[model samples]
Target: SLGLEKMPFFTDSTMAKVMLLLINTWLGAPYFMVLISGALTNIDGAMYEAAEIDGASRWQQFKEITLPILLLQTSPVLILTFAFNFNNFSAVYLLTGGGPINSEYRYAGSTDILITWVYKLTKEQSQYNIASVISIILFIFIASISSWNFIKSKSFKEDSE
Candidate 1:
């Protein structure tokens, strides 16, 4: 049923995926907003004045001055966001119980992420070793992507000194 407005929407898998995506995005965006606001607040007012003297429009100032500085300062926060979202399982588990009804899959629900599926395997099916293996794989994948993004953001190369 998945309890969408006190009605069952889980009968259709497409609706379920859409709902889950919305919920996950809702949970994630606030952290990004708070972080970006803080970074924006810390920028020196002189930079904006200089850009204005050079006849830069608002968009040009943001593109040339603001975003580059914010990206440089907030790289680690972005990395943390990706890492946290990589293993997020509770949102899917709580919403759907990982299923629509009686359907057969090997320890996976339609919405089951790697972390949630591993939890179900070890806790419900007692496949401890295999769950551990899957967890390690998930960790490696997230770590590699996060590291790459972190390094790429370091190329912002603003003169903070």
Candidate 2:
């Protein structure tokens, strides 16, 4: 069925590309969830057994052993997931076109992310310079957040070890 909400905000080619990215991300998360579940299964059962022997409750066992191990195994998966969600475009575009409209904002629809907005401006509006500027800003934001996550993961490893 062709719901109005299902339409992309811009029929213009520029916005179409952003919509595709959103779609890809929504599809990608299930794969990540599979990997995460597999990682959880790989955690050693022996540790839990030992914790139980020591009178640690199930919650304590999970908190002390399961979570740490899970975190260690899933850190990279988490990084990938974060990156995916950060740039996720398809889910947004397929559903809303990123707008029902907000004119007060310089270049945004209700659903526009920095990345999608840039795509629209460059492709639809022919505003290459502004698109590039927005792209740079997004790159910086993603890089900084990823770097922080990596650092924190490293610290977590150190403390746990």
Candidate 3:
């Protein structure tokens, strides 16, 4: 009845990915916003006042005071969000059903990310070993990225200090 399936938004190979991206962004933006807003609240009002007294413009205040602090506070969360979203299965599976199948790739759809591909590989094709390998590789890849980001983030350094 929703007619989502028949819609070109979900049926075209390219458009389906745009729909998936929009859906994923719509789902995730709130959580990131909450964290970021919390970080903004935590920033010392004294800092802004000090900047204002020194004749720093709002743009200058943001560039010097707000942006760096927010980046420091939220970098870890951002990295982890990336890792989580990188493996997001429900976003693709529920929205697209991994449909608008790609003619080029075997057993894969245009909107299908690694995790959804694993689901299809294991559940439908019974390609257990291939799925397992992909899962392990994905784990390693995401872990490495998150670990690197955390190691480089000011939060991690400050926490260690």
Best by lDDT: 3
Off by over 4 Å in 3: 1-6, 159-161
For all candidates, the clash counts are 0, 6, 0
> Taking the tens digit of each residue's C-alpha lDDT, what string does model 2 give over 65-147?
87877788778768867876667676665565566466766666756767668767877789999888878888888889888
Candidates in order, TM-scores: namely: 0.81, 0.73, 0.88
Better of 1 and 3 by TM-score: 3
Which window of 10 residues has the lowest lDDT sum in candidate 2?
A: 6-15
Candidate 3 on 9-54: residue-level lDDT in tens? 6668888888887888888789888998899999999999999999
**How many clashes would you count in candidate 3?**
0
User: lDDT scores for all predictions?
Assistant: 0.81, 0.73, 0.88
Q: Write the per-residue lDDT of candidate 1 for residues 75-115, one digit (tens) a residue.
A: 88878877887677888788876776436767787777788
Question: TM-score for model 2?
Answer: 0.73
lDDT score, residue 148, model 2? 89
> How would you order the candidates by TM-score, starting with the best?
3, 1, 2
